[model samples]
Target: MSKKNPKTLTVERAPDQTSEQATAEVAVNPAMNAAFVVDTYQSNILGDDVDTDALVATLRASMDKSAAGDLSGLESMLIGQATALQTIFVSLAKRAHHQQYQRHLEAFLGLALKAQAQSRATIQAVIDLKFPRQATFVKQANIAHGPQQVNNGHANGGDTVRALENQTEQIEVLEGATHGGKEMDTRATAEAARGNPAVEALATGHRPKKRGR
Candidate 1:
């Protein structure tokens, strides 16, 4: 017989495909296991036509046994919590954007108040760098004390009036600044231009010849 051609030979073979997958079992605590009824596989929640009293009694008895010795059985309190948690409504926590939430807080006011309170520590940072000693602050008034009451009790007129007038002038100058200060003198350029060389010479009448330097 002639040798069979390898390409012409036919054979039946099973089709290639992956097998069906199964989920692996995860071990959970016994307390959680109490949520499932062993025989019916129904969830033991509040709406069920029920066994709460039995579950509670079972929990109490189990906890009493486990708490002292068994250590693996469901505790009464934890069972109640886990069961109760099934019906609980959990609200999502809202996250405030970092800087926006504190936009209206008085942090700057707090800082300024702290600065005022700790005025002694408000010495210049430059001063701190150079001297090892802590600063002892001395306050100087921008406003001098009003005239002392003598036995005569009169403010000296000349000094007081001069100060008042000076203050009024300063206030007026400040007010003027808001409207824009007075324009600069443009007179010098005009004066120089108008007094041409001929006019200047005429005004001098004639120039004397200079003597030897």
Candidate 2:
């Protein structure tokens, strides 16, 4: 007998299963079918995208069908819609939270700015009060110790000097008070920017640190 060629003896085995046969054998469950239907409906509603009224009507119909016990398919459909709605609601909640935080931050900054403005006004008022008093004192001093009075060494010259000295001392005290007020204002602004408890106290014209101790 002639020896058979090894290459000729090789035969290609047929695939265990064709793609069409595999697909035919696979079964789609009711839940999967319901999910697909829900997805398709949502896609169509989104594509329309013109009015929320249509979406609402569709949702109401689904809900009504779910409420009626006549259809068993409604259960899976309701579950799929509920899951999608949950995701949407969660996203809305996150956006709302972010917006709320932004509003709060803006309100806080507004309050801080208001407090700083009030503090600055108070400091300005203090300076205004001091400058006018100093100007008056200087005018009185110059009038009391005019050239004639200096040349003659007027009897009241001692009293005039003492009065001017007292006035100077008063002006210095007012300056120190204004400086302290300014320092307090700066501290309050910094604390307010940091969202500290000191902000409330500062806004209310009270010192939080002193109260805390």
Candidate 3:
């Protein structure tokens, strides 16, 4: 039998086609696109209607029997409940103790700050009341002692004033003497420049030579 010519299937791609086109296509389904959901189940362990008093009595009886070595069937359950209750009470006690400690710490810090502020205010008040009085006393003492100590002398007021006047007159005399000496020197220099024989003789202690006829 003659084999039929193999059929060739040709796919036409655009010039911009790339190797990424060879990747497999992904299928999207509505079910896969749905959001995640969780279902929670809850049930009451003891019963739908619980009688707390009866439960306590039952647990007490079981504990009594277990203590007496009677091995009641509910002894393990009562022990488990008691352990859970003890853990919860211990946690509550720790929280209460921590809260009390925090309150005490905050109270102590507040008292310390208040005491510091009060002490600073008291010190400032004392300084303000005393400093000006001390300064005024010092200034008065200086003024009271100034006149008696002026000349280091025990003389009376009249003698002290006369002594100060004499010292002032001596200072003025020395200043005048210095000025007179400077004026005399300047006059001598001028006379020398004018060729005065008397000034030259006075300066050298010798007579000038007579000019030739």
Candidate 4:
């Protein structure tokens, strides 16, 4: 009977090569290290006898199919899942009805509700996949132009400009009414002032000229 030593399995480093150089060589190719890790992982899943190249090719094909937007298989799978959930929901509801304890009934009923919700979600997923919601993209233009003013009350091609001018004039009249003349000239300065002497003199400020009845 021969006894095996673990030290015999270890490879002795060359006398000329330093540890730092050996470590640098080992870490030289990151891509090769990643490939090595992937190989080991796939070997664990598919066994050492499986061809990793063929498996990788198949995975690439599946990815290409998805990238090409061929989703018939995915849609079928979702529909099948929805059907399965519906069956589960019915089964749970029946079980809930047959339960003697109130707590058990409630528990089963809650599970049935969850299954029902999952079924609805699956169906909605299919609907969304088939007839996708149309996305409205509002394009904003950063144009160097005049200022924009929005008049929600007025319709297009109406008297919007005219109405605005009228409003401005009315505002000016209202302001003038609210605040009386800045300066009143009742001095009868020139020919025009002398002609309307009575009109220029305010009744409040100047008493009516003594009229000999």
Residue range 90-149, candidate 1, lDDT tens digits: 210111222244643344434444444343333333234345487797643344334422
True lDDT of residue 85, candidate 3: 49
Instruction: Give me the overall lDDT of model 1.
Output: 0.42
How many residue pairs of model 4 clash at the backbone?
A: 0
As for lDDT, the candidate ahead, 1 or 3, is 3
Best by lDDT: 4
Per-structure clash totals for the candidates? 0, 0, 0, 0
- The TM-score of predicted model 4 comes to 0.45
Regions more than 4 Å wrong, model 4: 1-60, 137-148, 151-199, 202-213
Q: Which clashing pairs does model 1 show? A: none
Which candidate would rank higher by TM-score, 3 or 4? 4
Model 1 regions more than 4 Å off: 1-45, 74-94, 97-213
Winning model by TM-score: 4
Q: What C-alpha lDDT do the candidate models reach, one value each?
A: 0.42, 0.49, 0.45, 0.69
- Measured with C-alpha atoms, the lDDT of residue 149 in candidate 3 is 34
TM-score, every prediction: 0.17, 0.18, 0.21, 0.45
Tell me the RMSD of model 2 versus the true structure.
36.8
